[model samples]
Target: MFVKNGNCNFFSQKLTFNTLVVPSQPIIAPVGSDVTLPCQLDPVKDLRDMMVGWVRHDLTPGYIHIRNNHLDFLIDQNSLYLGRTSVSESRLQQGDMSLSLTRVRVSDGGKYSYFKCP
Candidate 1:
């Protein structure tokens, strides 16, 4: 189940997920401001092979790569999010794969999702 925060601006969820899990929480931020989209999980006992990623839901109907920890943004295939997206540096330890968009724009308002696997 997902729990909503006081301001109702963010949501959080937890569970014993299997494989690549998509916890619940679609962060929405106003344009022209900085925002962090958190993607976390209950600690998987053994994390020898875990992959996490943050993606933006394209209005035109598609998933655009925002940022991948090791490879960074897959810019060539994701031109729109090229320079406007970045992942949080604290992700590794904080279990937050949130993406920060500076100088947000109208185009930034949309569903944002994060995925993680073990």
Candidate 2:
């Protein structure tokens, strides 16, 4: 499947009938600028109430952010990401679990992962 994200076309796959698709290439952003990491469900599933999480698996408190209960949960978020990560509820309703990282820094360099509880 193909989904148009921003100015690029991203290829999507429906693995096991449900999957989250993201860009194949890395998103390059200048230091201190905000950037949106594109992510969306291939089958267009609504995730408003889903327990969606973004994390840096290598970190101690891996969690960067989480969304559920109709709000953002930050109690366990990593200190490096506090006040820097967010997800759009409106987009989540449409299955776009993209993470918005604000004020990028050198420490933020690395691969992040995503998961949904259920």
Number of the top TM-score candidate: 2
Whole-model Cα lDDT per candidate?
0.54, 0.90
Q: Which stretches of candidate 1 lie over 4 Å from their true place?
A: 1-28, 44-49, 57-63, 66-69
lDDT of 2 by residue, 4-103 (tens): 9899999998655787899999888988999998899988977888899899988889999999857999999999998999999999889899999999
Q: What is the Cα-based TM-score of model 1?
A: 0.55
Output the number of the lDDT-best candidate.
2
Across 47-85, the per-residue lDDT of candidate 1 in tens digits comes to 223455655556443444433435554544345555666
- Candidate 2 similarity to native, TM-score: 0.83
